[model samples]
Target chain A: MDWPTFIQSISNAVILGSIYATVAVGLALAFGVMQMANFAHGEFFMAGAYVVYVFYAIGGMPFPAAVLSAFPIVAALGIVTERFIFRPTRGNVLAGFMATAGVAFVLQVIVGQVWGVGLMRSVPTPYMGAAEILGAKVSWQRLLILPATVTMVGGLWFFLHKVRLGKGLRACAQDVEAASLQGININKMTALSMAISGGFAGIAGALMAPINAVTPYMGHSIIVTAFIVVIVGGMASIEGSILAAFILGFIHTFVTTIFDAVLATMVGVAFMAVILVVKPSGLLGRARV
Target chain B: MKYLAALAGLAGFILLPHFIGEYYVEIMILFMINLILASSFRLITTVGDWSLSHIVFMGVGAYTTALLAKYLGWPFWGTVLIGGMASAAVGLAVVFPLLRTKGFGFFIGSFALGEFIRLIWVKFHFPFGGPRGMIGIPSIELGDIDFYEATPYYYLVFIFTVLCQVVLYRIDLSRTGRVLKAIYADEDLSKCIGINVARYRAMAFSVSAFFAGIAGVLLAHRLGAIDPKNFDVNTMVYLVIWVVVGGVGTFWGPIIGVAIMMVIGEAARPLAEWRPLLFGGILIVFLTLLPGGLENLILRFKEMLEKLRSAGESQPAE
Candidate 1:
């Protein structure tokens, strides 16, 4: 590849990595705090994009404001999913996880019915100009994702490390029985973890609204990628997800540049399969005692 | 008395196809295929592993049959057996990487592997026929008997379904099935004993996939076409829903679940796009409130009846 093309691929990979990090971080957090593997996380991301479409494009709100709006709205959705679906089916992790597939179906049908599922909704590019770096031209809309991801992920790091509730969540993730006995509200932590999970996924979706086609079924594709990322990063390890997301993003972007999207996906999945075989605990995840 | 009920049910299956319209007959054929699919799925779950790629193994059987028929001109008998073996081989390969992971890890890993296989079909247009899938698959024929019509095909599927069900039922009753159940009950304890957990788990998975492949081949020949999309995750989720809603504890649970859901699906035809919403609702409700499924409900009723009968007998003696 030429210098410009190589640089462009690098920039694109970074943007792709940012979006993936934002999406997979929430999934990792939820899985870590509780064994709640949400099959509907991609839908949460899709819901975020729609939030942007509604508030910024249709409602004529500021793009940033609309993107910001996605966090709380979809976070509420995460809380509801926890309170109803995950809570009732708490003891059996797989059952709760499978129930989210039902949630995915319901969300898809509702979105399809409410919005015209025919043509993919094109959210207008809020930031139009391209930024040049190392002789590679990148769109401002895409570049914005890097800073946004860093901020969101950085914020999450801070929250988890410094906040009392965040410590409670970590404690629960470590040992539910011990955490509960120590006067931590397990219910509150699970709900909070899901809320943060939903919020991160929502923002990721909002960021990509203009970059990709917004459709109800869009979640179907990314959910596979997200699962691959989560597994490779280690099921519940946020840092691992971030690292794996970038690795996968680079793999996806470079492979797509060289070959096609299909081949890129195959390679990514192959990488994940190798990871599962070599290190089941993940890159950063601690093995269970 | 149980034999009489079984005989009557078998007779109804045979005779009912003749009475039903062509469309309903086709539905029955599909239903019987699903019955095999769901029950075989139950076989794997007996070992406490829920593979999200069960449907893809069905696709393995399907694409195998399609390729064999299209190129080699293999007849239905040859293709069905080969398709099943191919599916079993693929299932074993998938479970090989998966035996280390448990619960959610296994589920996600299986999905990734399944998607990898499915993508191979979508990427290569040479034999698998890309996204549009394969078309114009040759239908089954037995010299004078052309199995194109609804009734003949229905009977064919019925025969396969009954055979598969009997074999599966026997396995469930055998020492092997007990070993599988023991693994599900407590993996550590089972391992501490002489039970080979990984080997049994792998066996159950491949065997289950073997039957799923048969179902896929039967469906493929009936439809006279095949595609990658037909064996995607959505179909797998439906299978999961069927097994969950029906209860996988017993041999008949998933079958009953499929029967009930298929009927509801047929009735909900008017709902059109809204059908998934109903299904989704049913899945959540069943998983949360009725985790044991329809079979669990029936088992409860049977227990109640037994309790009442024994009480009456003792009261009369007193």
Candidate 2:
């Protein structure tokens, strides 16, 4: 590959990694806190994109504001899911995940019904130009993703380490009974995990709306990759998700560039399968009883 | 009395396609196919691992027969058995690496692995046709009877269903069934008792895939075409909903679940767009409110009736 093309692919990989991290961190958090894996997480991402589409594209609101709006909107959806589905199905991870699948179906249908599932919604690119960086012409919109992801992921890290509630989620993830014994409100922690999970996934989706085709079933492609990321990262490790996301992002981008998207996905899944077989606990994940 | 009930029910089912019209008969055939798929799924759950790939195995079976019959001029009966074996081989490959993890990891791993296989079809346009899928698959031709006719196809599916159900039922009733149940109940204890957990898990998966492949053979012939989209995660979710809504505890649960849901499915056919939402709602309700499923309700009602009968018997004796 030419140096410019190689540099461009690297930029693409970085942008993709940022998006994957943003989408996967919440999944790790939710899985960590309450053992709840939201199969509807990709739907939450799709909903975020739709939120941006409805507000910025259709309503002609400011693009930044529409993207900001996705966080709370999809976060609320996440909390509602936690309240109804996860809470009732708590302690049984499999059942809870399966039920979230129903949530996935409902969200897809509702979105399809409202938006008309026939064609992908085209959100006009609010940022239209490209930026030259390191001899590579990267689109300004794609360039923006790296900073946004760093900010969001950095903010999340600061909160988890410094904030009181964030520590409580960590506490709960470590030992539910012990955390409860320490006077932590398990419900609050779980709700918090899901809220953040939904919000981050939403932001990722909202940001990508213009770049990708927006459809109700768009979640199908993403959810598979997200699950692969989560599994490879370690089921409940936040940092592991971040690491795995970038690794997978590189794998996916380069492989896709080299061969094709289908083969890249096949390679990604195979990579995950290998990780699963080798280290069931994941790359950085500590084994839990 | 039990024998008479069984015989009469069998006769009624055999004569069902004669009375029903072509469309409903077709639906019944699809229903039987799903029954086999769902029951095979339940078999995997017995070992405490739920696979998201049973339908893909069925797809493998379908593709096998489709390709074999389309090009190789293989007959229906011969290809059906070969389909099962092919699926079983694929099942082992899927489950072997998966043996390292248990519970949720295994579940997601199986899904990833299954998606990998499905993607192979999507990625490849050769022998396995691409996304548009294969069409004009030759119909099943048995001696003296063209199975393309609805009645003949119905009877064909009926025999497959009955045969598969009987074999699966026997497996569930055998000592092997007891061992599988024990594995689910207490894996640690079962291992302590000399039960080979890993071997049984793999065995259960392959066996389940074998039947799933058989269903695939039935479906491929019935549809007279096959596509990669026919076996995907969306279809897997429906299978999960069926087994979950049916409850996986008993032999009758999936059958009962498929029957009730299929009825709702057919009746709500006019509202094509909203059907997924409806089924999705039902799944949430059953998973949340009736986790054990309709089968649990039936079992509880049966227990209540038994209690009342015993109470009446004691009162009369006194």
Candidate 3:
């Protein structure tokens, strides 16, 4: 293609990849530690966006403060779900995951009922104008996502490596029984992972609130993509999710630009199938599932 | 007594359409179709698989029948057979890559693969007709009895339903069914006993898809229209709700689940928008509190009745 279009596509790809990474990393972390998969993860992302809507747009808070509010609000949601749903259904991965469908339905209804489901909520663009790069103008709203992703993902990396609780999470993921014997509270680690997962997903949603049409049903599409990313990245590997996120983000953005959005999703799904077949353990995954 | 109950139930089914309004008659047709779908889905569950692609395979059957009837002017019988076979082929393709994975991986893999097939329909407008899907499908015409009539069409679906159930029921009772149950109970032990684990899993999945196709064919002909939305993830969730609430251990479980859910669904038609919320709540409650589902509830009642009877007999002897 032409130079400007190519440049725009590349930037778009990066932005998309970063958003995907933020959403997917949480999924991988929760799954890695507890083998607990949340089918309503897209709803977690939706809760994040709604957090910004309630805090920033309606409550008159600054954009940064609203975005920050999304994390704790949605993180609390995650912890609640873990304690009530995941903890009780522990060991039966299918039951816990399937039950999340109930969680999704409940969340959607609650959001829709409160917001009035008839019309989509429009959060005005907080950051006006675009940042020109290589003759291609990228909106400031979009450009903000890349750094936000790197910081969050990088922060997660440091926490996992440097922090004692994070290291305990890794230990729990590697072997829960062994980690518990070594004095790590299994329940605490699982709850922590879910909180982080919910927080990141919420952050991604908060960041995109202005760009996307904020509706109760918005999570439907994103959940499909998140699942594909988590699967391709290896079910529970954070590193694999990040790597898979970029790969999928680039694939989705480029394909949509070249062809159409629907076909791009098809291509992205086909890409996931290939990844599953080629590297069942995922790119950086150690766990088989 | 059981045989008499079966005969009476059959008589009710045959005659009830005459007494009901056209709307209720149509709903019964759909209820029957869902019964087949739920039962076939339970077949896969028998092998301990909870695939999210079951509805997609049903869509395959619907699309196949729609196209074959629309373009080629094929007869109803021929198109239905082609529909089942086509879904079976697609089912095999989906089950292939998923053979290596089990449990959660298999569940997600099947979902991704199912979505891929659906995307093909949504992306290409050639024969599949993209998102809007196909329309104006010809109803099954057998001599003078037109299937466009609600009563006639009910009988048409009824026959197919019985046939599909018979096959499914026989399979569940046969040696093959026993082996599949064994596999679900303990896959490693079944493998140790020289059972081809992948082969059986793949076979059960495809066979399940085959019956789902039969249901799809009935749906396409009845509705005379089909769309991508007809077989989506939400629809799949509803399918899961039906199976989970009914319990999957027994053949009749899905049937009971469908019956109870369909009744609830119909009764809640006024609160249509809130029904998903209700069903979702029901799913979580049933899973957490009543893991064995409605069938388990019935089985427990039976045991209690038998114990009461034995107690009465012992007291009288004493």
> What lDDT tens digits, residue by residue, belong to model 2 across residues A1-289?
8899899899899999999999999899999998998999999999999999999999999999999999999999999999999999998988899999999999999999998999889999999999998999989888889999999999999999999988998899899999999999999889989999999999999999999899998887888889889889898998999999999999999999889998999999999999999999988788630
Q: What's the C-alpha lDDT at position B47 in model 2?
A: 87
Which sequence of candidate numbers ranks them by DockQ, best first? 3, 2, 1
Kindly report which residue pairs in candidate 1 clash with one another.
none
Q: Where does candidate 2 stray beyond 4 Å? A: B311-318
TM-score of each: 0.98, 0.98, 0.98
Chain A TM-score of model 3 comes to 0.98
Give the alpha-carbon lDDT of every model.
0.92, 0.92, 0.92
**What residue pairs are clashing in model 3?**
none
DockQ for every model, please.
Answer: 0.68, 0.72, 0.72
- Comparison by TM-score, 2 against 3, better one: 2
Candidate 1 deviant stretches above 4 angstroms: B308-318
Steric collisions counted per model = 0, 0, 0
| Tens-digit per-residue lDDT, B23-51, candidate 1 | 99999999999999999999989999988
Candidate 2, B6-77: lDDT as tens digits: 899899989898888899999999999999999989999988998877889999999999989998999988
**For each candidate, what is chain B's TM-score?**
0.97, 0.97, 0.98
Candidate with more favorable, higher DockQ: 1 or 3:
3
